[model samples]
Target: MTDVQELSDWAPDWLQAITPQNRAGLQVPDQVEDSRLQTPLSQLSQSNHDRDDELKPPKITNITVMPSPNRMVKRKLQGIHLFMITVNGTLGIGLYWRGGQILELAGPLAALLAFLLVGLLSWAVMQCITEMLCIWPIPGALSVYVSEFVDVELGIAVGIAYWFSYSVGFGALIATLAAEFDFWTGTSGDKGIDGGIVYLLIPVILIAVNALDIEIYGLLEVVTGCLKVACLLAIGGVLIAVNVGAGKQGYIGTQYWASPKVYDRDAANDWGTAFLMCLSVAIYAYMGVEIVAASALESAPSARWTRKTSDERESQLAQTPNDSLIGNTVRFSAKYISLLATISYSLSGLLVSFDIPWYHCHLPRLSWVDSTANIDCSDVSDSIPANTTSAIVAIAVESGIPHLADVVNVFLVFTCLSCASTNLYVASRVLFGLTSRLDGGKGQPWHLRLLSWFGRTNRYRVPLRAMIFSAASFIWVPFLQLQGGTSSSTSIGMFIEILAQMSSVAVVIVWTCQVLAFIRYYHCIKRHKNVLEQQKIPQLSRDNVEDYSYRSHAQPVLAYVALAGCLFVLVVANGAYLWKGFHKFPFLSSYLFIVVFVAMWILLKVARGARWRHVDLSNPDKVVRKLRKLHDIRLAAS
Candidate 1:
């Protein structure tokens, strides 16, 4: 027997945590009490969690995941809400928190341009993801495609890289909350006492929100997304207005940019090093974009659950799952994944460059408690270099807005909260999608069966159990981070590399993995076309190349450029860390990025056997073909 079956008690009751209790009967239609599915709510209210355990589904030891298809009348979240997913994912704390760092790395002008460059590159990368997703629309976008179209072992590595990246990111998010409070009060609160409270609340809130139904998640994101966009717009407008002599500090236009050192390098020789480090910092600021592709399965209809196959029902599944909501969601997913973040980030960068000087910063100190004093940047020698947090504070102070900096700090706090929630949301879903396919259709091993326990979703279809399991990292890792709480030696801060220069490595790795997967996907398509032409075979009656939804505008060109750009960023992102000498960083900090990435890949390879499992190029996945058939009849009739 394989190791999975031999250890029956390994993480027992893990899958059972879905909606209190889960079992065989949970798969039965009548047993599933999806309150949102049965009828539309007249007045939307928060999902009540108290009654989730009332239904007693019969227990079974074995794991069996069924396809969940939506019938015509049952769903929340029109395409409009699809934008919420991507917006929430991309508009993270990085843009608001890193202004100070950007100013310090390079002058505001170069940093602004660098940030804009990263946005463009990020959009390019998302385009590649969009091309794959529009074709597949499967859960766990990159990993699923890589596993199905590329190789199983390689796919697993990519998926873990993604999972681990986001897992560490949760700590990064928590670390920021303390900083947010510090900025808000203009004084660092008692680290041990107050930090303890946030550590307790952050995970509980995320779990509570994510554990509920999809509608609740969608609603929360929509509201939060709107507020975040508003905040960005208001701040951007204020910054622009102030630059034109509208503030206490008069007529600042481009003066900061033309100041003594537009760039941070001392010598021409070190210019190369400074530029690359700045570029990496800019790129790392745009992490958390994968939520769009990661949540694609949930945001759009994959039709895993459907009525029994019959002439009518089968025909229904084949014709593009005709609903305006799904149509709009699909369309919006493509547009919004990069649009909101790109515009906001670019504008924000320009504003920061205009308002803040490279050297002096008025950002709150770590132990500051004064609310009624002028911030003197000239005297402070050990001030935290201007990052996004300090940038906002500096801009507000310059604008002559009373307590505006504190208000913006509060907004930044919400930004972190929303980001960590999104991370937990996607992390849980990725783990669920992987374990759900443990008993793979055409490719898988015996040991995979053991992990199937992490695969199930709750009755509300929220991946509740999987989400809770993923939240285990929050219990200790973030708690340690809170202990340090903006002090000199923050907990888990070293591990995540947010304080260090390790931030962009994870983003680069994820982008490269997906682009590599895209290359394989491209090969599969051509290989299929070649086989069809040689065999003189007719296209399947319900199949249409056009039916798979949106085709990426540029085929391999977009993907290739994206891959090259990401690889370049990866090599250069760590230049700052390297300057201190590679030997200085042990295992815990930013340097662990490469080590963790390679080690995880090797470990997965050994577990899968000596060699990787290469997907058969001659035959693409059945699900891919099935999805293409969707809208086929619609296209035929048109």
Candidate 2:
């Protein structure tokens, strides 16, 4: 008989064949049986796993835990998609329509100062967001970070308020779109086409665009974003040319700014009050700049998915603690986009002032009866309102270029459509994030279970239910138009203005929450650092503390500044009611979102039976420690 050692030297196929045939007689070798029995199960299992692993594909981790709707969403968005989404969101109908109104209310200097101040605040808020997102990229993470770092009740309130803001903003854009159609057809009187038809059609278009794969939506945004950027740059250049004597008007210079009457007080009847009011308009222009942070889950690096083992993931994370793809993109986009937007806003205000004097700009009185009637600002009327026309188009028309005005009107229509689509996207994602926290645990309330249904994804991994619900906000457009009489352009414009006021307030509140959350997060890090120092552990380096993937300048100081700015805007913007005698329209539109936020917080707190003492700050702090441990392990491994 051949010895087992001699059989091992032969081919395995031949050995198997011989062993099976000679099994009963071959088992006389006790040495071979004892060697097999002595083999460890772990070694045998590992060998078998190795053979099986070679045939299997790599495993990809989901963005969220199992059963989460976010888990179903594919990370298809790249850095460019994120950039375009943000630009598309930030640069919209607000700048095109409200630019002239802001200048009319507050002169060129005040408008410029308001925009610059708000731009700085926005930049600071974005820095806080970038720091948090780099460490944990999650969809709709704004509310999540607030919830973890602050009170859960406050988080729920912020989420609901944000969702409301975007939803209402979507409806406002739809109204703007309908109004634009009226502008194109030159129909505004009793003989005008039904605005309701256009309102219905706009929502349908938004739903169609949002229902497609995320990649397709992203690509669409890229096209629109490029067009918007080009359009703005062209408008700026044309405005410059017109100011420098390109048009028949000839070299206007800063004649408008030089006039003292142009800086007359606004509705509040005070120059300081008028300047404070412009802050809200400026904030509205930059409302959606933070969408880049919201898109972090989809734009995070693909390196996270390719790790072969847990150890490998930890090692890689430690080696590059600040190597987030989304973080880098956000940092780049936030810095340059904020700067560009500030310049665009200030330059547009300056040029528009030069192109058309404040007195000549038509500020429409927002009334249900004949809303198109212009409020004469020659006397600096008590009711200063937004312009009933696009400032860009107005500038072109004033330049003796009717054809250019037509071109600009077309661009404005497209801008409204693009912004409405983006608003729906944001609203739906916020709803998804809000519902995802329910977890469908046993004994959940009926309302929570109903909301959780919207958290589910369809075949394409899109939140179809949530999106459809969000799109329902457009229904308000038709209702407002047909309120008392026939639908008119003025009514639609009024609706848009009301929604903008509400949305602006919501934006300020959201920013305030984010700034406060960041302050808490900063303190959390400090506590961890203190503990490390006390224990004599190697303290985190200064680079680790300050310069992560994106460095937010001035630490807690910038955060405090942002916080103070947001609170100031929140109070002063709505304070008009004190002097205006609390008129229903202006008062409700400005303070309605604030009321809703407080009510929602109280309701949530009651439902959860939550107390201030029970708030948890440790979880977010633990995240910091976990990353540090990985860094330490990597050092040891190397």
Candidate 3:
């Protein structure tokens, strides 16, 4: 065997946490933390990944041996699949009820404006994440990127916060289902299927669908996305036809805009409340846009689908599907999804402000959340609460065509079902990937080892246990909402708000960290570049200044701008409730989500203890280990 000094000499720069001066007695840990997902939480302490040989794949438990080869996740996703995934991922709440919030807070014009501006800023945020994904090409991307580019603890913090957000967001979506169920009972000849039955059925169906096969999951997204695209087109066409006297409204275009007010005209706070609050609601609408990054590592490119040819061979030589091809596909997926978001939200802005009357413009049940707002459109038709189901039903009732509303309500159910399934899928993978990072072979703590089991994939290559655990986490919230009844919506209203509040906080923080992580990533690369130049050593034969495949050009600047813009919106978005004094709760309620996120982060730190203190980059004794594979990609691509 070679001496330790010889081993140290051959280590990749990114993998070198020990310097030559102290190489004599140094004992490097033999745990490779490099993979698409990087290392687990336990592996982060000795943040330097062990060599590849040290990272032999963990033996799969043959407790229940299966016929097929065991893999954590089947890499079956393709371009169209990823494109559909992005579409479903980004356009969740926006498709159903978010239009009403925008229309209510900022009116039609401002709502449309809110979507465009926010979408642009959000896209900027995506650019940062895309850059990271291009370089890293890893699973559990957000946490892995944050750990390597920023701080490992911060990565764990982001993972936890994101998990909480997705969990609560799932509940928020489920809570609204009750309002949609109202449409059927009120209009469908009293089928006798109450909201409770719908609630119970949704989770079971989703779990079965998610656990069966990933191909089914991809197929589900494609079918649902096509239907959603069709629905959006139909809704837009309806808006156009009705405005042009196809309906009795007779050239109704912009008439409602003029009457109910073009903007909310919250003239008090310099009209900022109208725009800012709408921006806040708009944030939720576009919340899932960045999901492309989360799933990119698993997204299979066109090369995976087709048989190779002579022409394609040259392209393959230049780029493999894993890096450039996959990166391009991911970028394309994000683009199409963002484009869809912009079109849908803008069209909805026009359609909702015109169709759903000003008075009926309450929260859009989310397409049924706050039933108190549905008082007008209730079974008795006494109070009309502001929601998509209620507003459309109210319009249909006014037009003496109640059946149409039933169809729309049914359609909204499908929409929410698709969105909820996606959320559950995201939640399970993120939580599983987070826990997987802590896997420390057989020598780890009992608790750590026990939790690691939850991350294991079953026969279908699905994190079956993690999926069930995630399903169970927020499953109870909606049940409570069902029990609260729509009479006053007393319990449901507060509960949804709390969930939304927490979700808003956690998601925003996670997003902000992504932007900040990019900045740190740029600095890390620049530092490495400077050191290589100073030492008169070429890092790679083909490494020029433009070596990075997808550099975040003018990086820290764009990152800073995106970061500031998102943060400002986050502050105003949550606190807008208390801004006008026409609010329901206290300042504490608005900021409660942030408090919860910090609490979760601190608890995680306490759980981790002080083993990782040396990982603090600023410390003099800190051991630095950059991602080695990331360097290989830059060299190969360049």
- Note the Cα lDDT for every prediction shown: 0.57, 0.63, 0.60
Pick by TM-score: 1 or 3, better one: 3
- Lowest lDDT 10-residue stretch of candidate 3: 59-68
- Candidate 1 to truth, TM: 0.75
Best by lDDT: 2
The better-scoring model by TM-score among 1 and 2 is 2
> Residue 497, candidate 1: how far off, in angstroms?
3.4
- Model 3 per-residue lDDT at 379: 25
Q: How far is candidate 1 from the true structure (C-alpha RMSD, Å)?
A: 12.7
TM-score of candidate 2 to 2 decimals: 0.77
Model 3 accuracy (lDDT, Cα): 0.60
- TM-scores of all predicted structures: 0.75, 0.77, 0.77
lDDT of 3 by residue, 1-638 (tens): 12222222212222333343444432222332222122333344353355344356542211111112322466677777787877776776555566665665555676567788877777778778877665554456788777766666778888877877777777777766665775544422122243436567777888898897888788888999888778667656655544454246444546666744343433224346556766766777787877776666566544322467877876765545244455555656655566668777776776656665543533342212232432343423343323334334444434434365566666677777788888888888787767653543566789877776766688877888888888888888766654554322365666666676567667778889899887776665565554334322222112463334455445678899999987887676656655656444324445776776667666767787734432333321122234444433322221
